[model samples]
Target: MSKLPLEGYRVLEWGLWIAAPTASMMLGDLGADVIKIEHRVTGDPSRGLDAGYGSKTGRQSLYEGFNRNKRGITLDLSKPQAKTVISKLVQTADVFITNFRQSVADRSGLDYETLSKINPKLIYAVITGYGSKGPEADIRAFDGLAQGRSALAMQAIPEGPVWVRPALGDTVAGINAAFGIVTALLVRQRDGKGQKVETSLLSSLMFQQTSNLALHFIGSIPVAPIPRTRPTNVMLNMYRCADGKWINLYMPEADRFWPNFCKAMGIEHLRDDPRFKDIWVRAQNSEALVSVLDPIFASKPRHEWIRILKEHGCVIDIINDYADLPGDPQVIANNYLPEFDHPNYGRIKYPPMPVEFSATPGQLRRPAPEFGQHTEEVLLEVGFSWEEIAAFKEQKVI
Candidate 1:
């Protein structure tokens, strides 16, 4: 019922895959009019990507997930006629977002320098793989590559680095870019001046691990990869139960919950034991403590342990798999995974905007547009005549 936070803003997105589109998608979710520009012929490459969840209907979950709440248009930017269209769109856009490499952007005249010259007040957001000014600035990068370069992949066990799935680097970079764009919008509102905003998957990945990476940066220590079975804190680790289901505990203030935790586990005699008397001692003797707790946890099913621990006010939770999310009560109550009847995919769910605003809540007004679904409408909004639109279409420019 309330107007959304980003109402009255216009965003022009020239992106593919996840990062740049994701930024625009968030802006769209917040009520901005986001026009997603794609290649005239092929559209977004992700549209065809199967992602292992592909259906006989040829729907792409990846593209669908990232591109909702936006209008779609196509433009062959290489064509000179397309430049005229882009210039018109830029003049009316409050923000312009792209994740193209530097050379690609320059060649297509979508770089900040060129676009800003067209509209002096345009907030240009650039998402890159490395950064805008580094040695690898022009290098092409994807989620896996950025994660590997950012040392996130190396945080795995001694067996080797693990590749995280579902595009962690890209998603984080996109979220960071959206945050930067909103901050820039505030500055623009204050001074009526727009500037270039930049973020990279590498930088975002590093930011994600700031607390862990701080040890290496501040103490000048080479951080070793985490070992699978070696936990720094016994109380802050996961245990397998009698049913083979895993449950994780998080009593960081172990001393405060020591007696209650012991009572819940029916091991109150061990509460006063010197070897596990406090957080520090438990951490120091974590291996020994794990040995003591493992068999006890294995004595009960996950549900029983969960009930007992929660009854005793111990911080605990079950490790849910992907299939558990759709039915999760907390997830449903918070609307983290909202459902909609997609035209091609039938009934499905996608993640919505994570933050909630009491006064100005966001909404999913529409699904991601079909390829070039709004080209004519968007062109008319930007001041192109119907004749020009038809001519551009005849010339394969839109």
Candidate 2:
């Protein structure tokens, strides 16, 4: 057997969409025995939303990307019989997660009050749009809404504040929620009890904007158009090499590169030039300096510039796109991806857990399950007799 850090840990993921399920998926990545509990018939809405795979696997990309190691069981918790089944499963679960509105949890009897009592050591984690206590606690939220609310859009783009292509809020919230659960698990190990660990899109977005938040709080003006190209280091901007490929130049300010930055563009005399002397001066005269440096960089291909920069001890990195990612040396070096013999999708390439350990490493135990795949097996394990399980299935209750 492989040595996985969370080999025996059991997690019951009741999440529907990305933010909630992605959290459990991280636990699954860490080798937790994650059991995803979904509705009986419809299943998780994301499981079949994408089009390229046809009906056989609509949301394969969504599920395969996030849910690599968990088992699935569909239970209509809205139904009394399913709720009873869930309560029994709660007793055997180490963690429980949900993302519905507070009222919905309260109504469904799946809130902390009910489940925590069933299993006092359960690490209950959640991700919401707003918090459960704020004025908008009950209101539903999505990544775009949180991004718009957190002013993340305004920070990145000057004109209209564009969102990143993927859902940033959802991913951030999911990661935060997963960390909170892991933290709470540590606390439980120490105290022999569990507590609620929760995160919200609003909170995650706030965490993402710590610098901007501090600036606003302290009344400092924040500049716009915060692409990584224009970093705090004035000489460390994106430069188009002679080949017209852009690469990032990160370096210590006022170092060897500072002199070279000016000389490479035939502006060595600018080293003593007042407007090009210090970072502040360079920032103030950004247009003037870049105007000189930009063309020098545009003269060569990115690889050629990288070679020159390496020879000159200029810290730099090639800007990589998706097409250039598969062969990225570092990704392969760390074995950051796993190949799976998926049932329908053979030899699928799924991202492996990002964490590494010397002894107790994380693992990928199973492929994402088929819809309602473990309904009968899970219900039976929860103490439902065959006759009862058959009746429920016949009634469309399982």
Candidate 3:
């Protein structure tokens, strides 16, 4: 098989929930061998966070989604023997990821300082709420809080930042960590050494709004003199369809597209309308345009509008929910959704590795493991004896 970007890499994913797990998933997509370490009894807290819907938990979905093509192991790292086992795994691991709080990792003996000693060439990746070193580092932060403090919510929504249904911070930081780890791996390819890489939800939020942040240092940006209450209601906006579906009309300027869009909506007169020919005129006439177009759009179903606007090449998108995302034709054509058989769940659906390889393609090799599923085997790889393993299990340490 042709070698993928990370064909020879060994990654140990000691992460819970969104960010860190997503990074591991990316590596798995690129053909790296990843080992996901979980506690023996509880596993990741996210596993149980979802209540059983129809007697099946979303946790099952998350485990499969975030952690396909990876090995799983159970260890009670609280035990000395487990730490010994991990030290050996570190020796072979090229990349190590953890989202544990600094205090927790330090207490658990998984801090970079401790693990780096075992494998100085390991690329250590970290995802934090705020950051590892800051006044707010020790303070607990979630995506909503970061989005709020970073002015993302205020600038966009204004009423109050809505808690995103999905964990955007985790996914963004995960991508950052993925890039950082890959860069570190590339550096190691040249210098034959490893380095530390870190990202935080707050930092990722700020990065996502780099343009907004730059306004502070450079100068204040000119806000369009539109009497819009929220940013979403700017020049481009979402319109509700007759069937109660929403479509985004996203031409941020009163340009060719906007006129074409109004024409498509059967209100071609808007092109010559006195209050909307220029951007300034459109700014004064936004409410009138929305009022006129709303009923016209409501006269036709979203599907019909989609077809007509698409023919004319208007920039539009049908608002998609979770179900719509997976079933999208483009997503399917791109092979973004991949399914595999799980040990307990039988056949399961998981998002495929995101990278494409024209040669030997990447794959989702394994369903997420059962709790501590590979403990004995991984310990054996590190030269631990049966007696030592038994004693550690008896002590509830791994």
Which candidate leads in lDDT?
1
What candidate 1 gets wrong by more than 4 Å, as runs, is 51-55, 220-225, 272-281
Q: Encode model 1's per-residue lDDT on 353-381: one tens digit a residue.
A: 88788999888888889999999999999
TM-score per prediction, in order, is 0.94, 0.91, 0.90
Name the lDDT value of residue 48 in candidate 2: 69
> What is the TM-score of candidate 3?
0.90
Indicate the TM-score of model 2.
0.91
lDDT of 2 by residue, 1-398 (tens): 56577778889988876888888888887788888877777778777657645665434678667777888887776777777788789998989988887888888888998889989898888788888896888898888888888878777654577776578899889989988988898889999998998899989998988877887787777656644434455566787676556788777554557876655555678788887778777676767767777777887888877777677666789987766766879877887666778877778677667667877777676888777788788777878899998888887777
lDDT of 1: 0.90
Ranking by TM-score: 1, 2, 3
**lDDT for each of the candidates?**
0.90, 0.79, 0.78
Quote the positional error of residue 164 for candidate 2 in Å.
2.5
Between prediction 1 and prediction 2, the one with superior lDDT is: 1
Q: Please, what's the RMSD in Å of model 3?
A: 2.8
| Cα-lDDT of candidate 2 | 0.79
RMSD value for candidate 2: 2.6
RMSD of each candidate? 2.0, 2.6, 2.8
How well is each residue in 54-131 modelled by candidate 3, as lDDT tens digits? 545434666667877677888778877677778889998999998888888899899999888999998999999889
